[model samples]
Target: MRLPIITFGMALAFCAVHLFVGRLRWLDRTPRSRWLSFAGGVAVGYVFLHILPELGAHASTFEDATGLDAPLAEGLVYTLSLVGLALFYGLERALALSRGERMAREGRDRPHHPVFWLHIAASALLVALIAYLLNHREDPSAAGLALYFAAMVLHFVTADFGTRADHPEIYDARGRWVLAAATLGGWALGLLVELPELAIGCLFAFVGGGIVLLVLKEELPEDRKSFFLPFLGGALLYAALVLGETYLAAA
Candidate 1:
C-alpha cells in the first residue's frame, strides 16, 4: 500500500537517526520503566498493526477510517498517529532532561516530572484496541500488522540508544557509538533474517534516529517543561495534515 511506503520511510528514518548519531544521555528512564515502555509499544503494535485496520474497514466515516488507512484513511487516524508520535517524542525528551538533572543532583529524582507511565499506558491501550481488530483471519500478503509490530519494536529499541550508558543521566560520547552500532547491527540482522521485511524494519529505525537528532543537540537542562507542549503540538499538526491529505485524495 502507498501508506506502507510512507510508514516504511518513517520507520527507516527512526533507525537511521540513531544509527549515525546516537541517543542523548538525558532521555533514558528506569529499567522497569523502559520495559514498560517496550510493552506499551508492543500493545500499540497489536492495535495499529492487528486491530485498527479491521475497525477502519467497517468505519464508514472519514474520521474512523483515517486511523485505519495504511497511507491515508481518515482524519482521526491522522490525529492519533501524530499525537502518539508527539507523546513519544515528549517522553524521550523528558527522559533526557531528567537524566541530566539527576546527574547534576548526583542521582536524585527530579521533582514534578511529567507523567510518563500514564502516557505509555495510554498509548499501549490505544494500540491494543486497534490491534484487536486484526483477528487471526486476515490474509497473508495483506499482513500489515506484522509490519506495524516491527515498526513499534524497532522504534522502542532504537529509543534505548539515547538512554543507554553507565548512567542514562550522565552524558557520554561512547553511548552514541553504541547506538550507531545497534542501528547498523539491526539493519544487518534484518537483512539476514527477512530480506523482504528489511526495508520496512530499517525504515522504523530511521524514524527513531530522526527523533534522536532532534533532541540530541539540545542540552538537557534547556529541554524542560516548555518542550512538552510544542512536541504535542507538532504531532497534532502532522495528524491534521495527514487528515487533510487523506480527504483531498479520497475526494
Candidate 2:
C-alpha cells in the first residue's frame, strides 16, 4: 500500500537529486571520486543483493508459465542480462571515441553534442522504466523500495558526472530536464502497462546486467586512482540494509 507511493516519490526524488546536482554548489566542492565510488558501490550492491535474488525467483515463475525448463529459462534471462551489459558497454565506449574524434577535429569549445543527448535520452528511458517496474510489483513494501531509491539516486548521480564531463553546458541546460521527465513518464507507463510474468522477469534481468556494466565502467579505471574505501563501505552498508530488510520480513 505505502510502498508504491514511496516508490513513486523516490522516482521523483531521483529527478530532484539530478536537478540539484546540475544547478547546486555543494557537490562541486567535494572530491568527486569518493562520491562516485560510493555511488558505483551502492548500485552494484543493489544488483547483487536484491535484483539477482528477485530475478531468480521470477525465473522459476517464468519457467512455470512459459512451459520451458527452469534451467533453460534462467539461462535465457541471464543471457539477456549479459547482452544488455555488453550492449551498454559498447555504446559508452563508442560514444566516448566519437566525442573525442569530434572534439579533436573541431578545435573549438562545442556547446552541444549529439552523443550526449542520445545517451542520456536512452538512459532516462531505462531509469524510468525500471522505476515503473519497481512500483508495479504485486506486493511492494516501503523498506525494499527505500533501498532501491537510495541505490538509484547514487547511480544517477554517478551517471551525471559522466554527462557533465562530456558536455557541461548541454547537460545543465536540457539533459537534466529530459531525465526528470522520463522518471515521471516511466511511472505513468507502469500504471498503464502490465507485463506478463515472463516478460517482466526478462526485462529486469536485462536491467540487472546494465547496472553492472555502468557501475564497473566508472569504478574501474586505467590510472588505478579510483577511491576504494567509500566504494567498499557503501557496498557493505547497502548490503546490511538489504539483510536487515530480509530479517524484518522474516520476523
Q: Which number leads on lDDT?
A: 2
Model 2 RMSD vs true structure: 2.5
Question: Which lDDT values do the candidates have, in the order given?
Answer: 0.38, 0.75
Clashes found in each candidate (C-alpha, N, C closer than 3 A): 37, 0
- Alpha-carbon RMSD, each predicted model: 13.4, 2.5
Q: Estimate each model's TM-score.
A: 0.32, 0.88
In candidate 2, stretches whose alpha carbon ends up further than 4 angstroms from where it belongs are 1-4, 24-31, 108-112
What digit string (tens of lDDT, one per residue) describes model 1 on residues 65-124?
Answer: 234454443343334444545656675566657657775887654322344333333333
lDDT of 1: 0.38
Worst 10 residues of 2 by lDDT: 24-33
Candidate 1, residue 44: the lDDT equals: 38
